[model samples]
Target: MDFSGAIFEGGAYFLKAKFEGGAYFLEAKFEGWAYFLEAKFEGDVNFSGAIFEGDVNFSGAIFETRGMFAHVEKIEEEVKFSGAILNRVFFEDTDLTKIRFYGTAIENAYLAGANFGNKRFIEEREAIDEERNLLQHITKALKKPGLKSILKSMFVFFAFPDNSYRKIKTKCKPISEAFRRAEDVYRNVKLSLQNEGDYETAGEFYYKEMLMRRKRTLYEIKNLKYWLFSHIYSKLCGYGEKPLRVILAAFFVILFFGTFYWLTGTVTGEGITDSSFDYYYFSVVTFTTLGFGDIHPVSFTGKLATMLEALTGAFMMALFVLVFGRKMLR
Candidate 1:
């Protein structure tokens, strides 16, 4: 049944309607509420460029084959699809901020270019409660079969990159349950974006996923060793992104040991020099493992400090090489 370009000025109802063949509603406009309760489409259906000035309900509807509703320009109010089954639906280039998908089965859905709106921090308790309710609705929708695939397809649409880092850290930080699921969602999105050759965006999502993992490890896993390692690896070197951090760390280590040597008077040069410069120079040489015969450590503390500095230098140098190599390769 073709209703292409048809205009329904009043409310439209197709309750329990069955379409055995292709159903077309291209560019249709609904001025009032539109309901398709329990309707079934057995063949391909198209509602591309449709406009609904009022709320649209598709509760209990079923699309057995492929369907398209791409480029829906306007939906005046919320669009409900509770208990609906959609097969291979296309919602590209649509705004879905007010779309409700409670108990909706979205199989092989394509949501590229769709806008899920920005998520802001809700400070008010009432607003937070509302957001929680909304989250619950979305969670219920995600309970469909093949949940991973559905999440992968819809992630890029809903996870818009509007100051995402700050949003995730501040206002839009997911609840514990959502945070766990977000790890998988971000990972899948990253992989998908990478496959599509969007490396820049993929890298951003990868970082977000890593941040989520870090939080999970710190709060949920409660492993101090792993958490410490992750913290150092990430902040000290930005997961191999910032090579300068290595140099900075090395500088601090040199300064600390140099001060120690000066205060303790444990470093000696070939001459009777007890200058700060001499101590600093000795510290640098020792850190670099350059055991110059001109200068040596005199005390046990100096020897221990020298060994520690040498180990630190080697480790930092190795890390710098690895990080630099990774950046260069990328």
Candidate 2:
């Protein structure tokens, strides 16, 4: 439901409906699913500290400005951002992507089917950024009795990434072992993403340490978020249409040779002798280097034909091998 262009201003509100700036959702919230597909914006759009019970589908949604999502609590359901275009995306210490909240529409976080930025969650978080005035915010949040419970749950995600289990082993005892165990899981998750060409995520494990040591967000603490984005964007989108082009080139070569070979084997003489078994077989053997001597060329054109067939064979094989290898690596 788009109406923001007709309403909304530069402040926050607890609205009962949607936000649409011509179609941008800027900084607004609904009580349930938030939909703002096909919206255009001129500045940053923030969806900070909002909640949704249903899937967050932003497929094909275009944001001319950066998109900010943070502090969304208890959204234990699938969160989809497929095909949503944006200038920048921010996920600040968001635990929902890593921790599945119980109840509501989500029975389990896995069942929630959360897909964070190309299915690569847990990017280099611990770096200088997470530490962003760590003492300031943690101390501030710690003072609020209301935030204590949530922060305790949030610690399951924040503190456990580095096999901190041993370093903090005696620091926390017995039941707190779950915290260490969770840290191991977090590290494994980060490792898996790193293995799957998600270095930004794997890097987060190290970055998180950077933050914990220094106490801040990577950008705020170290200004490395810019570098992180440069690396992540390239890996995610990669080289577009190169693979597609190789496929097209292959088809073109196949079409050219298939037609040429088919025509070459056609009966061009008055009575047609040796059909095309000899010609096609000759082409195959010539291309494959299996030069059996039973088939001898009697004419100038026939002997010349053998040489051309051999050349085509080499070219096609080389081209196909290159194309196949590129696809496999991609």
Candidate 3:
């Protein structure tokens, strides 16, 4: 059943169809809804370089052998496979950013290098800059009011420089909708990866999911406190998935308090000393609540700084242990 480079302008239904041999849909374009509900594929199936612009479904379908869908460029909506029997399906090097998986169970699935539209802060900033530049170009071209200028603006709008970093298509829909869908997909994929015993990948997806959620809350929901908490959680320990971040946070806290103690000046048996190392040593003692009593703060501000440093240090130590233990236990 060859459908190489075929174009489906409308609905493509193959309900309960049985393909006894290999099925090929290489470079096919699905411009509308595609359905293969309860279909049976007895041999290998390929859909490399396909473009799905609408809804797609393979619910209850059975793939007796391997199936592949690599290098899919654009998928505008969900490509559901709930209740499908995917024996060995491969989606490597595919962009699944807009797709959603619901109630699906995957076995021997290969999803290496798949894009899920999970952008970090740096990537998001780059995207924003790109958008700003594009808008500026478009505005300048439109001000001329000529066919050539209009064409150039259109070209610039559509002919975005293709790169690995461009995962989400910002023009497809609203940013909030994209974020919501991304959050949902990340959660589902995280759960799927956890079920497959890939904790490290699952943790990465979990971080992405939280990032999307945080953005949604901040921009869409306009929840200031919630966003602040989420931001702090990400910075402190990456939602408990990165123990190294906790260690760094603790080190920074100690350094900050040490500098504060040095600037404010403390007391020793030999009176006040301007040495930075002595203040740092006293800072460490205060942070750990050692309380040797050989060194004390003379001014009220210095005493307050020591008290706050002790409290902060204790909290940071506990947080580090909690984060590290969570990672180790998992």
- Candidate 3 whole-model C-alpha lDDT, 0 to 1: 0.68
Cα lDDT tens digits for candidate 2, 99-121: 22111111101111112321211
Task: Output the better candidate (1/3) by TM-score.
Answer: 1
Sort by lDDT, best first.
1, 3, 2
Q: Global lDDT of each model?
A: 0.69, 0.40, 0.68
lDDT of 1 by residue, 128-167 (tens): 2222232332333333333323343442212211232333
Residue lDDT tens for model 3, 178-253: 4665566557656655765667766876877788788767556568899999999999999888889988887788
Best of the candidates, TM-score: 1
Worst 10 residues of 3 by lDDT: 151-160
Q: Give the TM-score of candidate 3.
A: 0.56
Clashes of each: 0, 21, 0
Candidate ranking under TM-score, highest first, comes to 1, 3, 2
Query: Model 1 — which ten-residue stretch has the worst lDDT?
Result: 121-130
